[model samples]
Target: MNLAILDGGTHYHREAIYGDRYRSRFDRAIYAPDLVLADLEDVGLLIVPDRIDPVLLRRHRALLDDFLRRGRTLVVLGGNEAETWVPGVDWAFRPLNYWWWLDKDAVPVQQLVTPEHELFRHLPFADTIWHFHGILLPPTGAKALITVPGDPGNGDLGGALIYEDCVTTPGRLIISTLDPFYHHGSHFMPAATRFLDGFLNWARHIS
Candidate 1:
């Protein structure tokens, strides 16, 4: 499967994303323009990070929408440099890095929800991923994944949603607004192993 991480041209370098075993799992991980033209017909998922601009997004909206329309999945990450994605669908990483700790640490337990859901079935991820920087979860229908004091940058419960059993398309589609690639490959709790077990289990077979 061609898993593309939309980089929307931020200062965040392309090489920095290396070092994850998951890297090999992806037949190819690329950025915009190139990603836009790749045939999504055979692709399984698109994991975007702050990528979506009028030019690119407008050009590829049909491509992206068609992918989702066909039941494919899309994940978006948000932070300071996020401004390109379609607004209502986008969430912001609040003030603090809830998952990443600068001083203290938080415990991680499997607060699993929707186990029957295909994505979470037999997966290995705490109910809450170590929130380093997540979208400023909007104030509406987005589901609640993690509750807090709460952290300003809370990951939206709903934005992580995948419509698998809905219309003519029985496929799955998800849009996330946080960077869950285990940045720096630190393999720390709520960081590395914390999320890998779950996501990788049912991961689309990448060539």
Candidate 2:
């Protein structure tokens, strides 16, 4: 599938993570800082890194709204410490270097949170674990298939549906504050690869 990785404005670690996790699965996964809102085509899926600039956010918002209307999947990873053109998304994740999650017990990666959703196919639940800080949305029409319980430091809480079969007429919106792919790509490739397999499959299946 054709996918695009929009790095609104990123740091070093973010690049490393995207490279390790999503390097090959996509027919093409590019990292561009100058990408405009109107530059998007039928990219099937879009991964927006936390590098989004606030100044440009206003301009890109309309284009992104349009993209979601077309049934495209927009995945936002939480590794960044910047603003996103995509608004209203609340990301849940912990820093890889944070002391709160230093121990494995602090944040155990969940295999199955919402199995009923189509995003959980061929997933090696038992063998995989992920490190996420804060990646979550308001749960509007977007259905959250799975979620990691929240702790004082990290993890995501359950919310309303974020995806829609017929979003805004001809276009459908698939928004996810979950950045498992980003986390995996940055630190654990095996987990990231496993998650991407499911993530990509889910993106393609949505309207």
Candidate 3:
């Protein structure tokens, strides 16, 4: 698939987990304190996980933009509070209720906004309901795949948990606040494992 994942020194356990789960088709590159542009060659998709060095990413923003200008894909799986590295995204931090599933008769508020999108071909709704880091306000003409349910009284309580921005740049960008890789590596969330498996397959086919 020629996928490359940028490691921020937090995905160490992913090696062992992937070895046991399924063979990953993606390569990993250290997010060296100083980002290197050459590491991205021949990669169709670039994955940026959580805890990425925003400063380093910002320093090399032009390179990323140029990469996108060639119609490559970028998958960003984190929330950035200080700055926008993914371009055309406005982030809002939400207090996550991790234990919400433990409660009796609990129902997830996150809903699939674009149920017919091809991105959901491999990924089911159940695999995406675990937890998310925050919400995203994507740019115009973007497709929001998942969002919290809106409340009539509260006036649009739902915000985008996952979305794709094809208009913001020359390439396609799938941005989410869900830390799927971290949870999958730790083996703490079964849904994350399912998510990663399906996501990789989907990306492979898409690319």
Candidate 4:
């Protein structure tokens, strides 16, 4: 696949976790502020990682929408506050459950809302189970892939860890709170690396 990754350009966490991997794996790595529509030419997949410059993204929003209209794929990672830039994603913060796994009876799981989804064919659900930044209510007509398990009728924002909105645009839009890029780059979460390896494999196989 002719993949392109939008670099956020921060020198701390983003650089540590994504710099090397993006440099090695993607076809093009464009800095967010420097990104222009021309950079997306021939790109089959575009990845907008977390912590990107919102102003720059907004400035290029029209171009991104146009790119999607061409039936390309857009993968968004880590945007709890970027709903204004993204077409149909809305975010909500949840109390971080940092110690959920520490409980003896705790079952820290990310329910696969779409077990039959193609992404899962490449990645196991177990690899996606990890702490998230927050939950979000996906745009209308979006298919939720993973979600926080909660009472069915409760108004809890268990949050969707992974979701996609294909109806909002001509192309597929996958958004996630799963910050695999950061986790993998920091060498903190092994599962994140495994998840990303599978994700990249899936993206490459798209014809």
Identify the leading candidate in terms of lDDT. Answer: 4
Q: In model 1, what is the error at residue 190, expressed in angstroms? A: 7.2
Local distance difference test, each candidate: 0.46, 0.50, 0.74, 0.77
lDDT of 4 by residue, 38-78 (tens): 89888999888766667778888898888889999998887
TM-score to native of every candidate shown: 0.58, 0.59, 0.87, 0.86
- Clash totals in order: 14, 28, 0, 1
| Residue 205, model 2, lDDT | 55
lDDT (tens digit, per residue) of candidate 1 on 1-207: 555455444433242244444455455556676665445656777665433354766566656666766666665443423334333344434455553445556553224344555566634445335554434333344443433333237643422322122233334434444444434233334453445445544555331
Over 4 Å off, model 3: 11-23, 27-34, 80-83, 151-157
Query: Sorted by lDDT, highest first, which candidate order results?
Result: 4, 3, 2, 1
Could you tell me the lDDT of residue 5 within candidate 4? 80
Which residue pairs overlap in candidate 3's backbone?
Answer: none
**Arranged by TM-score, best first:** 3, 4, 2, 1
Whole-model lDDT, model 3: 0.74
Q: Ten residues in a row with the worst lDDT in model 1?
A: 158-167
After aligning candidate 2 to the native by TM-score, how far in Å is the CA of 176 from where it should be?
Answer: 4.4
